[model samples]
Target: MRRRAWLHVAVLAALVAAATPFTAGAAASAAGRSSTSASPTLMAPVTRTFTFNGTPQSYTVPAGAVVTITADGAGGATINCTYTGKGGTGGRVVTTLPATSAPTTYTLTVGGSGGKGCTPSHSGGAGGYNGGGRGGPVLVDGTGFDGGGGGGASSVAANGQLLVVAAGGGGSGGVVLGGPPTGNGGDGGPDGTAGTAGGARPNAGVGGGGGGGGSTS
Candidate 1:
């Protein structure tokens, strides 16, 4: 089986407003009262990154500030026999969350890579964190052929509302006896569709399912 490169990244940036104190009166007295001026100050932007550990992560943003969120899905696993069928790559998604009157908390879920199957097994491996699909398994006579697992999806939410989602890739299919394996797995959802797994074999191992896509609403 051929080797594949896996890369997952997430970056967030937020801009907020600030105020600066004014010196004593800058203008001469007007009609027995001193005049003063006030201006809004722009604060520096804040950037952050999150890592995945089979659990959800959280971040807080200041009130009255706009926040941008970006997420990447994980890749699927592959199966190797005489011939190698490579897994699909992960997908990416970007969206923004509007500012609120009060400070807001957002939750992020990173995608996980699919399980692998280099040897024959009774069942396929489990899917990664998030929404990755599981690989297919086959039973022939007294032996079982296992398929690779699917990748997981990456997601972001705030106030219980889903803000953005990135789809994961599909897993590779099982191999046939004494020969090459089936076709390779499908790519992740480009726009918002789910990932697709490779072809399945009759009375043999089946391909894994792809991860589901996310929303930007």
Candidate 2:
């Protein structure tokens, strides 16, 4: 009888030992899963905001000079810009001049018409010498719901002698309830107009076309 009891106790001890490992393994697996789920994901940095006035303005760049401009977008959209340059003998002429080593002064201007029904949150492109004008807003269901056109280019001569001018086109306006639901505004005219405004819908609006940039001797 004593031997039988001892044999039974040994069998129970063995079973308990065998079960302990499985329980420990299950707990470890659960912990690992939890740790993986709790990990955080990294993301890229956000772009900074910029803004510019849609007015006809002028700026001067000395000979062998360079400049950069920035603008902010409205309705969670990005802004765009264009550049042009002209040179002359006296008082900066709008001629087909090339970049030079000496410093010369050239004037820059920016202007654009009113956008149609689209929001007025867009900035006009920069202009020099003879930049083209911007286009009108996009048509929304024939409701004239679009952005305004960019300013036209100037017809000035470089070096006060030869006529060297570059004009950009205006940008198209945005649309709503159109195809694909997430309608966007038309892009700015190439090499002329200012940046176009973004559509007001949930998705991002089309970017405005940049004006043509040039340099004169």
Candidate 3:
């Protein structure tokens, strides 16, 4: 009985000795693998705005990202020819981008407002134009009136693709005559073309109509 007890004690000690190295090594391995950083949490949505027309911008969409864009047209300058040129239109767009294996860079642009101005007299220098500003006629030689300019359109681009567009406003008409006539300015549509200028009656005075605004496709 005493010999058997001694054998059992020796066997138990050998087994514990063998298991001790493995248990210590596993604990050390687990400790080494642990991270210092905390778990990830949700973040708020992102947004950006463009006030000028036709300005180019760039951004990247991350995993599980949603995007929205809004574009507004500039108002046409008020004038007193026979009529005034109208203001430009505004628009909005929304889209979702899928996750990419790697971060993808996207090209973006926002449209600007057209310029507005007039000639000095029956004959004068050229006025400014761009984006939404359509060229109006420059009356000269005869005793006629001046004219107004049209507004410009806007555009939104994502990943080099056109997503949305807001149309431009129209220009007003110009007229000069012998009798007294009302001079009114043209206002732009919400998302459409502009109105024509107030014209002369029965071949009375000298003047021309304003141009229409642009659109997105």
Regions of model 1 farther than 4 Å from truth: 1-40, 141-144, 203-217
What C-alpha lDDT does candidate 2 achieve relative to the native structure? 0.26
lDDT of each: 0.61, 0.26, 0.39
Superpose all Cα atoms of candidate 3 onto the true structure and report the RMSD in Å to 1 decimal: 22.7
Identify the runs in model 2 with alpha carbons over 4 angstroms from their true place: 1-144, 151-158, 161-172, 176-217
Give the candidate number with the greatest lDDT: 1
User: What TM-score quantifies how close candidate 3 is to the native fold?
Assistant: 0.56
Using all chains and alpha carbons, the TM-scores for the candidates as numbered come to: 0.75, 0.26, 0.56
Q: Report lDDT (Cα) of residue 96, candidate 1.
A: 65
Candidate 2, poorest ten consecutive residues by summed lDDT: 1-10
- Sorted on TM-score, best first, the list reads 1, 3, 2
lDDT of 3 by residue, 1-217 (tens): 0000000000001101122222235666777864333433334555654444245556665543444444444443334444343332322223343333444445544333333335525422122122444434444445454444444445545556765454444444444544344233344343433323323223434444444444442
| Tens digits of per-residue lDDT for model 1, 131-217 | 666676655532434567777777777789877777777777766565345556666765645568766765433432322222231
The number of the candidate with the highest TM-score is 1
Q: Native-vs-model 3 lDDT?
A: 0.39
